[model samples]
Target chain A: MAQIRCTDLTLAYDGVTVADGIDFTVNAGDYLCIVGENGSGKSTLVRALLGLKAPTSGSITFGDGLTAKEIGYLPQQTEIQRDFPASVREVVLSGCIGRFGHSLFYTKLQKDLAAYHMERMGIADLAKKCYRELSGGQQQRVRLARALCATGKLLLLDEPTAGLDPIVSRELYSLIEHLHKTEKITVVMVSHDLEAVMHDASHILHLKKKQLFFGTREEYLDSEIGKTFLGGAGNA
Target chain B: MLEMVFEMFTYPFMLRALGVGVLVSLCAALLGVSLVLKRYSMIGDGLSHVGFGALAIAAVANLSPLKVAIPIVVIAAFFLLRLSENSRLKGDSAIAVISTSALALGVLVISVGGGVNTDLNSYMFGSIYAMSGEDVTLSLILSAVVLFLFLLFYTRIFAVTFDESFARASGVRVGLYNMLIAALTAVTIVLGMRMMGAMLISALIIFPALTSMRVFKTFRGVVISSAAVAVICFVVGITLSYLLDAPGGASVVLTNLAAMLLFSLIGMVRKS
Candidate 1:
């Protein structure tokens, strides 16, 4: 089943269209990478998909009446957020709040789930450590674990590798790829790191101002725009 | 110490003032942590000025200041909330515009009327000595309501504080929560005005929260510790005011500042 479907979607702020008339779909277990330059409505499109912003026109439907708690998201890091004083465990547990509501009481299962995800993300030892004190790569991993705790069926990540060392970026991409393969979860990611995204993406969606091109990796490799932007067919 | 307690209990106004100060401080401390986290420490300052303006106007018009101030401040807070969301006006600019204009208008109204018989000094710097039983009851009721709301919306509040966009994405109504916070802040400003007065009210809102941040890791811990700190400051400040015969509002703010400094020193020592 298609986990996400957007039909004739248009998004605008203050009546100026950023991206318009977009049509897209993601099947279960599909790994789709949205590649675009800055100000090309990449983030805007992701915001619309996450329901953070309403589309000016068109309909977006998720499979089986999936609520927000069923979709995990990793947003781009900001300096202010990095300086926020919360422990790693505390940060991750916040993801479960969608399920737990406003109650201070937490079920044993929820606590165990948070711990399990942290361990799975290889940050179990840093659970008690302050989030602000972690290395950039480590912080990103913890955020990923936090996102994963909320939902494993579908994940939306925006600029997950931006501003990180190339090695760390590669590791993050590899981790996402591993999750896609092992968990069979559908993933939609917005990223400027084309090489890493193109390497793992089964499907590529290229976005420019008011335009979108959706195709398989092979088709993207054959296209003139993709070839020019990505450097070569091999890279695509 | 025993004699001092007896002196305090013997005076009805003193007992009432203490009750009002402690209750308002507790509620302010709880909300203050979230306010600081959201980088809106100045909001309390802004709203209190609005409250003061309403109070001056109400005093001149022979209306109950509490009745007039509550709705006016709440409306002003709503306006500030909406203005902040405009993305055109920066957050601080919006706060400055609302607060300064409201305060200036208030001053104009007072001056035009040649000032009411009310002592502005007490309102400006807080005269906890003048608190009546009605003020104490109002403070208690407001604090209870605020506390209930905070507990009811704790999870959504945490989500919004951590990441507003994320909270909205998770099906929480971001606009509703923002307005709710603004309204609560307005209520806090009005309730606090009686104890700390307009001039020094925000200090009560900010100091305890900042001091607690040095040690607390979780949001809940911050709230708890902030309240504890605020209660300490209020009790100590009131006691000192009684002994020293100083201004109650200024004394409370000074006490809060000292506590902050002491905590910072203790934290430094631990770090070293």
Candidate 2:
């Protein structure tokens, strides 16, 4: 069953059209990579799917016992967030804010979840370290841990490897691949790297201003839209 | 020195000033951590200028200044937030535009309606001597409300201050908490304007957070230490002004600055 379905979605910023007539379905346990060029509204589409922004006119329906609030999101980090003064523990623990409901403080259960995710991310030792002091790879891992504490069922990452070196990017992809294959967390990601787009992605949703293509990785690699992005190397 | 300290609080005005000063300082410091983190620290300055304008109009119209200023400043804070959200202006630029224009309007109100009065001195540059018994009562009630709301929303505030987008996606109502912070800050700044003065009140909001940030590595640590530092500085500043016949607002600002410098030195030593 589809976990999330978008129909006839159009996104705009201040009346300037961003993307129009976009449709996609994220099936349960599917690894969907949203690939697009710069200014092609991949991030915007991510925002709309996460319910952070309302599409100009369309519906984002959640099914399979899933809700928008239950989705774990690793947002693209901004400069202010990068330099924020928070400890690794605090950052990860806050992912349980939604679970707290009206409670003023975190419960022991939430703390344990945060700790578990920290261990999973290999940053358990750095729980007390300030987030701003961590390296880029460490920070992204910390963020992934935080997102996991939100929901270990479905994870959404936006440009998780935007600034990392090739080695670190590969490591992050491997970590994500482990989560997808071993833990069975459905993964939806927005990334700029067309080269890294094929690996582990069950499906790809390539977005542009007017055209959007969503299909299996194999189908995408065979299509002209994917050829345009993946280039001739898609065959190799 | 102990007797002199005891003597200062014996007077009703000094007692009111100490009570209100400490209360406002604590609120300002608590909110300041988030404000500084969000890079919206200067919003306090902008709102105080608006408070000054409202006070001037209240004086001319013969209304209670606190009553008049609080709502206007709160609305301005909300307006500024809206402006930043919808308009192209950033928080700092919106603050600059609103604060300067309000300050100019305040000057206009004072000059056109009634030439500089003794009241203007106390309002523009605050005086502990100017705090009335009525002001003390209002400050007491408002301070309690601010403290209550802050503690109640502590978790939400911490989350939003760290990463608003993540918090929002996590189902935290970022807008509601942001408004609560803005309104609380507006009230704190207005009340503080009576003791810290319109010109210097933002210093109350800025100093403690910056000082604590220099020494503390975590948000909770910074918040707790900032509040402690604000209260201590306000008390010392009040006492110093009373003893030295100094302007109360300037005295408090200087005390905060000294504490900030001390924290900076400690931070340097630790790093070295």
Instruction: Please give the fraction of native interface contacts (Cα pairs under 8 Å between A and B) kept by each candidate.
Output: 0.31, 0.71
Cα lDDT of model 1 by residue, B104-157, tens digit: 877787778664767677777777766777777888888988889888777667
Candidate 2: segments with Cα more than 4 A from true spot: A232-236, B87-91, B115-118
The 0-to-1 C-alpha lDDT of every candidate, in the order given, reads 0.82, 0.87
Stretches off by above 4 angstroms in model 1 are A64-69, A101-105, A232-236
lDDT of 2 by residue, A27-107 (tens): 888999988778998888878877889989988999998899889999988767776778899999988987887788989
- Model number with the top DockQ: 2
- lDDT by residue (tens digit), candidate 1, A66-139: 65557888888764476576778877877776676655655788789899999988999999887877898999
Best by TM-score: 2
How does the DockQ of candidate 1 come out? 0.49
Q: What is the DockQ of each candidate?
A: 0.49, 0.77
